[model samples]
Target: MSHPQGKELSIAVVGGGISALAAAHRLVELAPRCRLKVFEATGRLGGVISTVHRDGYQIEQSADNFITTVPHAVKLCQQLGLEHQLVETNPQYRRTFVVRQGRLHKLPDGFLMMAPTRLWPLAVTPILSPLGKLRAALEYFVPPRRDDADESMAAFVRRRLGGEVFQRLVEPLVSAVYAADMEKLSVLATLPRFREMECRYGSLIRAMRAQRRLHPQTTHESGARYSMFVTLRDGLTSLVDALAARLPPGSVCLNTEVVGLQRA
Candidate 1:
């Protein structure tokens, strides 16, 4: 908390979102003596991540779950002493469905986002047309883009698999999870491994097949790895509350908008 000149450090965090709160918490943990202030533009905290309880039901305003494959969120929860409140997804409902022509069809087995580990399932899936299925299968022969330049998720899927696969399968599945426009979402920022798979194995299908061979247990899995997701039993807002509780009193300034910054 002290500079080299022996002056006390003063830190200001702008925003009341989960990311800002987490950063503020980490700062307090690492520098207990520092003067820290959090400025929030809104009167409420947690931003879009809010959990509302009504009539014995918990409704999430935005993201309801966090993936455990990445350890950061789980680790943070542990640090906040909320590990006991963590609840896993129900085994009976750990599946995703896509609406095609007013009917809900289960995603193809081993189809995780854009890559399909099994060809037979993708071949027979009702989500894609016969031509779309054939086009997706042909992804194994499509040449990989060797450049390192960034591209949209739409462009990447359409180029590697086909327009039909992007519009029908990949578009819906990814959009449901991220709630983003595929045309604007960056492939590198979201699912970089698929791009790496293409660069390494020359084709996404080939890479997925090789992966399935190595991890035979995932052969029946589809869409995202739902088993890895979890949430607080009380709701995600508990995390924000826990974080706010750790900050010193009078440190949070809500409804304070910071328009610009000038170096001292």
Candidate 2:
């Protein structure tokens, strides 16, 4: 687009992944006449977000769905005129299960990630032992960590909810989503809201209970807020294709990896 100095602004995006493609598309929308280029190390786009079709079924390589609570993906789809293709998760199967001793047990209702909004379900879930359940319940009275320092997810869960809850419940659930080591995964970088809740309400259980009271519909929900998740009907590739289509012709340069940069 034209700059304040009456010159066209040129932009270069490094990567052909969904994030980079979305950025280029947004830039094009905001500045229709701007010069842009996208460089991809691989010959293909979409990164790990690929969909394969075979035998009348769609297979997702990585993430099959995106959570709508973030709003960015939904807004992007709407902007690309692909809102009609969005599909919500089945209502009847919104719950998540965790395996313990080679058996599947339903995650407690109203237990969203690390905290439980409803205590009754947490009290009754077989996922935790009597001692574990009692420990989790004590979270209501646990003092908040007053400092702003960062801590690992494992540490955070153990400190607030106890080791049993971390091992049997939180670890599996969080690992399924992030696939990262709990000992190294930064709680501040991932789910800072939990820390904020602890600071504001002084206890995770108390904070979650207050939130449930504020948003009563979530009282019966469970696990990772599956009700907020959705996927594209055709597949996530449609989103990549739509983004690539909206860019100017010859804007994408595949198999072009930048090794170093220097001042011109």
Candidate 3:
């Protein structure tokens, strides 16, 4: 690959996820003189990230909230002249995760990034066996280990605590994030902060607790303005439609598939 300084270049982006849309948008901003082609496999861009609207109902496939802590999505909205259209999640559902069985379980308050440090609930929660609970509770007393470089979400929870926590708590939580299986999941890729959290606080719980101390309000976010789950009011297709409208005439070749690429 060559970097051309002080020269315009044509760019092609594939798979119109939010990333591709953002890339195309940036190419327009930074290199309007350069040609931009977004080749999406389907008829529409945004891939699994599109939204739908039907008679007062909105639906989404994937690529949901960009973290409030992360400025990229929010800033992009602002730049798109969409700040007013930015709706925070519904306050009622802001502190939500998911539940399967017959109980309403709140992921421990102040727990950030999928690690639980603060105790009371972890000890009493039925999600773990008494032994598992004891084992997890032991994190407070056990000194941090620096030798281990990485561990799977399954192995880590099972070793430090028990299988129940792995299957019930970590599995569902991790799966929801990755849409993947926990056993083969890469901890380093998904949860690198574990190493940092352990190293910094000597315990995951302590790190979570400390983080909570810094952002106490994020803990009790009930009835707060906006929520963690959110989407556009006009449905996501509005975004793709707008993007398609901006393309130059004859820029798109429809109903055609290119199977390979090579240099002449």
Poorest 10 consecutive residues by lDDT, candidate 1: 1-10
lDDT of 1 by residue, 1-264 (tens): 567777777889999999999999999988898888999999999988999999999999999999998899999999999999999988666667888899999988888888888899888888889999888888989989999999999999999989998887889989878989999999999999999999999999989989988988767778787788999999999999999999989899999998987654
lDDT of 3 by residue, 1-264 (tens): 223665557676665656777777777777667666676666766667767667876777665554565577667766666667666666445554437487767655433445664577666665567876777767766676677567776776566555765666667667776788777777777677776787788877788788768866566442112344445556555555556555655554444455665432
Model 1 TM-score is 0.91
Residue-pair clashes per candidate: 0, 1, 2
Q: How much is the lDDT of residue 183 in candidate 1?
A: 97
Can you list the residue pairs that collide in candidate 3? Answer: 89-227, 117-205
User: On a 0 to 100 scale, what is the lDDT of residue 160 in model 1?
Assistant: 91
* Model 1 misplaced stretches (Cα beyond 4 Å): 262-264
Model 2 whole-model lDDT (C-alpha atoms): 0.90
Residue 225 displacement (Å), model 1: 1.8
Q: lDDT score of model 1? A: 0.90
Q: Model 2: runs farther than 4 Å from truth?
A: 1-10, 262-264
List CA RMSD, all candidates.
2.0, 2.5, 3.9
- Model 2 weakest 10-residue run by lDDT: 255-264
Best by TM-score: 1
